[model samples]
Target: MNSARRFLLSFAACVALALGMAAPAAAQPFPLTFDAGWNGAGSPPLPASGFWDVQANWNNNFQAGTSNNVSPYAYYQETAVIGGDLVNSVGDLIATFAPVTVNVRTFQDTLGTSASSPAANRRAVAGVLVQNGSTLNIQSTGRLSVLVTYGTNGATTGLPTPGTGSVAVESGGMITIQTSGQLNVVDNIDINNGSMTVFPGALVTAQSINSGAAGTIALSGNASLTSTGSTTLNGTTTISGPNVVFNSGQVFMGDSTVFNPVITGGTHSIMNVNGPVTMNGTLRPQITGVTPTLASSWVLWDSTSTNGQFDFSDDSLTDLPDPGHRYNVATTTVGSVHGTRGLLIVENFLTAEVDRATGAVWLRNTANTGGVNITGYQISSASGSIDAAGFTSSLDDDNFDGG
Candidate 1:
């Protein structure tokens, strides 16, 4: 090759590198760092709020991956930094009203590894802030993974104090899933002061939903939530879902937990658990888009086993449509067809009747009973009077038990 041609090719390559728009290298786990600052000022200043996938929003034009491991997947393994600006280092991603897919697998900060005085610099800990009415959509293929953390720098003598990484959504911010969006969080979703809403036509299967102090998680409109690990409801977690399935773990509901499920006709919200449930919470059922009727009942939650019950200290049943009717939390053992055994909110004012000829007994309600599934109820009685000796009892049997 001639010297002139070689020089020209080398200059072109340098120009592309200087522009920071070089072609992508071979597929691998690479660092994609955010270039903007808290106030939208950095090497490549982005708007105060914008889409996350825009190439200019990242440093060195390092964009999020567009494909996943298998065919027809939206996201895959990606490691990205959230805060990297030297002057104003707090990374902010405000996605207002628009639907956004954070295709970056991990949002981390690497200042701990780069700076000399790691503790003195603010970049020691990397964090991302998603606020100002923003909505982030995380779509995954349900591949459970581990938590992504930051690295620590090595100073002259000993190792520097290790830094941390976090993702927070505050100020009415939401992490939601809609339409074909399915979120599978391999790590913890620490919404200590944020919200995560799984809308209708969407599903979210996570390892766990945790709150350091307080947070909110709402599910509504035929939405579903499947948790493989334990979930602690420490704050006001409102669930108006047709189904909330716990695959194989427990659920802890404390005093601060509140269940505000909306009933639309006979289709009310329910939590189906395959494991035990420990609750010391409150349930506030709301009737919506449907009128009050007789023989109506709503199953609050059902599980294979349960510990404590809701502390219904505050007259929560008064909010129902029928003010004159009575309500009670009835425990029912159900078959695998309907659901595992659980509790139900039914009309309390019931009349116990027995047919002496056949020993058939059933509950008759005169007031507005509301539409409730009566299949879970069973009736058994003693052969003789309460005061009689050698009294016998009938075998325990319910329709669901196939007896």
Candidate 2:
């Protein structure tokens, strides 16, 4: 080859080699990098791991791509918000990331005392949509409350479908779901060792709720919860403490169930059952036992031979002008109430019938075995005395003597 020809050929060969060498280097994966102290610059997109957290103060909102990650290592010094849900063109809005822990620091715990960290309510997350499989771990003793809200639009609209995700409140953490909105979790939940509190008039629903070994649902301290659905609490439920109350309207069918409610310490609680309760285990309380006071209400009790001591009367019995009646009991079954303690009132009149054979008394004329058996005895107090025949005669039994 001549000089010019050789030069061109040599240059082409060098260019090909350089291009080949750069190909692999350009394809190498790089770690995600973003500015933490600033916001409004558009949330940096994350990989399949949709991990994100807010600790101190983030005024702006964060937007995620496929899977992302955000960890706020300090207390929320300012208000921080998550931008929007991640939905690709093909159609998938999954925000599954490795567990995220927003460490909440306490100045008192650090310098005040010798302890560096004290469990308090400093590390809490309020208002946002936490992608499914994302965990908000309350790492420090500082408390952590996660506020999850579903928008009118986007993947977080909470459509009840399969493949839906959840925001797990793991151990060393205490999360409170404040939204009355429903969270559609296609999978199960894990709240074994953590503390979770959902304030009054709040409704929480899950695909399945399974707590600690034996399915324990402890109503700790003065905290109270009102939950609905089929729950299996295998642990002891203490329903006492002046402030501890759990008004659970749970109804379980007749397979086999367990409840662990307590009223010990100084806490107080009320186990209210709106529907049927079937407990295969025991109905235990924290104190000595449940107390039934005279009230203008119906105490409906339905149990097999396994049911313990209970007192139920008609609602009219406690229908005075003042003082509403209340029933008290302690039990280990955490899903339903142990008993209903009051008179069942219906319409204007209070009707009750006592059963002899079954010992199951009922009101509204549904307990007498064969018609209203008066026992052929009359109570004649003054003029209202029990004659030789079983008849009610007196102002006490006289709604209408002629009839």
Candidate 3:
């Protein structure tokens, strides 16, 4: 059966069981709580081996056993006072058998003074799989780190493939990496139809991020994501969604890499990049309904350095605003524009100008010459002007014969 159907069935079973049970004559029993440690008084300990769902060791540490599978439809609402760790010494931390929800609230522990203490052991091995509608929520005011890595074996015979054993935050559910929480994935994070929210003061680092067409990642407050590799956006997805606002923090999209994400203007939403933004793909800045003035329109690239290139090869800058409105793509230093077959259609007027003092703009055609295909380029300004400045050709034999 599908994941959604399975989750519904499991939830129904839990409700039925709760309803069938007789209520206590006095007070209701409290929910089970698991403290951070291998052994403690009145603490629900984890198991040592076998499946994690086994009831033999209910007061042990939460360890991912050799089977690498947890109980299906199991929900753990853990209020950890000293913080808990989910260690995996073997294969991937798979939750595919059933949908599991882990609500973890971590606090400061006074056990050891070293960096690697019992509180610092909140980690997993061979990556984490939240597929089949599983959800992992981590809320903390202190540090809570989880690093998903591959074993000593290579990818050929490794327990999980490099960048293959991804943390799937599938759709219809939520996986929250709250403030003071850090989750580093060695592989790609596939946000396939799921909702993953990274709150401010939290860090989520991954090799790459493949956001599905229907998946939504709400990067709000001061939350930051550092992608060591590339981030590919598929389907019809926007960087900002309802209740999703990105006002602060830097989202470093690697160095000298072309990162493309479809962006739309919303409340306090802007595409803010700190390093060089080399966009070889299309940057669809949707302009409809509202008029886009110079100050109110979207600012595509606000680079901090001079070595950035905005390549518009096979790109389309669509739905340009009406007359008297402008869409600006500005950088601090030198910014280059490449248009092999790309088109910039404006409804009124379009000015591709650069700051004459601190910066320079380069516009070149497919041959890297002054020749540009602005044949159908129409500007609603008086005289319909098309200005091409700072033109230079590398071909020694060719000459500029016409004015």
Candidate 4:
């Protein structure tokens, strides 16, 4: 539904539940078909179009021009299939409460006029082509599963026609998940200049994320995001949480100006890509739980093969504590340690501290646990290199273990 009409419908659903409004005792709910006034409104003056939750818009046996709204109950928790197109003719947008599934058979926004239509004429849509500042909120009590194009009419009815429809959140559109809200998309999410925010305590699992040039995804607080397939992010992914996991497949990172992965204690953000990773842009890593000692290393990107490298010069690695050494990143084979090749940040320290008073030189064990040998190690200064045989004579009468 469009504008205040659509917002009022969502509000009314909440009020109806509070008022204990129930369907008729004889009414048996069934899968609703999106006829959308295709066959003139059964009731006059109400128009053929209506909201998804409204009783007048749905048809029980939808067959294009002959279907009628035989079902008297509004679809609250029933699985619905949008067969025909729903234009924002007069604010006929859709917003429901805790719907189990909303299958998009064809293009829901076939007309594609709502984006250019007036505010009063635009629909607050939840299906495909959710654009033009439309906001779809998944309540805490709701679990909305959007099954994108599969067959001719989604996964339910395998129509003869091949599925060519796709969903895109573009042009200021948003899908916000409230606390404890869950949204699972069977197909990839193409965020074309739009955004999806998962608030704290909320969860969103998608097949993959195809971020457009202007698209963005903000995972705030303790929200969890799991993308199963390959994710090629060309926009920004702002994550304030610690539970974002890219479990499998290749991940191509590109133009991520706001990507920051944090490391807290023994647990940190991980992108376990089973294939190659094409790296680009800046990856700002933060350490919160533990202090890094000399020769400490952390693996940020784990993959079988890496194509490119991140712009480390634009990172905040210098903010970390430097114990007479600097932190640098390198693409190395971590198979013996992590079973894959990855990009790791290591603290390289190899200088010795000399006690001039007693003429003692101390080389701390920064990398290994056992003793270190400096038998043939070169020690040079501004004047010249010290002779190995006569270097000990130049020092005070202090004991040298040589290890």
Which candidate, 1 or 3, would have the higher lDDT against the true structure? 1
Give residue 86's error in model 1 in angstroms.
Answer: 7.2
- For candidate 2, lDDT tens digit of each residue in 88-197? 33444443223232223222111111111212322222222322232332222233333221112112222211122233443444444332312223233445544344
**Candidate 1: tens digits of C-alpha lDDT, residues 1-403:** 1123323543554476578664334332112222222222123243423334333333312222211111110111122333322232124343222222333222211223432222222211233445544455544322212222222233322212223233456545567665445555444455666687766656666566664335688777766777777777766676664554334367788887765666665665667665677776676666666654435666666666777877853336345445334444556665432344554454434456666666555554434434334444434447643332443444333421321
Candidate 4 accuracy as TM-score? 0.51
- Clash list (residue pairs), candidate 3: 44-59, 45-58, 45-59, 45-60, 46-60, 46-61, 170-194, 171-193, 171-194
Please identify model 2 stretches exceeding 4 Å from their true place: 1-52, 55-189, 192-208, 245-260, 264-268, 282-284, 288-403
What are the models' TM-scores? 0.51, 0.32, 0.41, 0.51
Across 1-403, the per-residue lDDT of candidate 3 in tens digits comes to 1123334543554465477753222221111222221111122344233222232211223443322222221111122211123432245342212344554454312123321221222223233445445566666553332232221212112122222224666565456778876665556677777667788777777777666656666665556676666554442324432233222122332222223333443332334344333333233455434444433533343433323233332124444333223233444332322211111222223244454564444222222223222434322337744254553324212321110
Q: How well does candidate 1 score on lDDT at residue 277?
A: 75
lDDT of each: 0.46, 0.31, 0.38, 0.49
Q: Which candidate is the best by lDDT?
A: 4
By lDDT, the candidates rank as: 4, 1, 3, 2
The clash count for each model shown is 8, 80, 9, 4
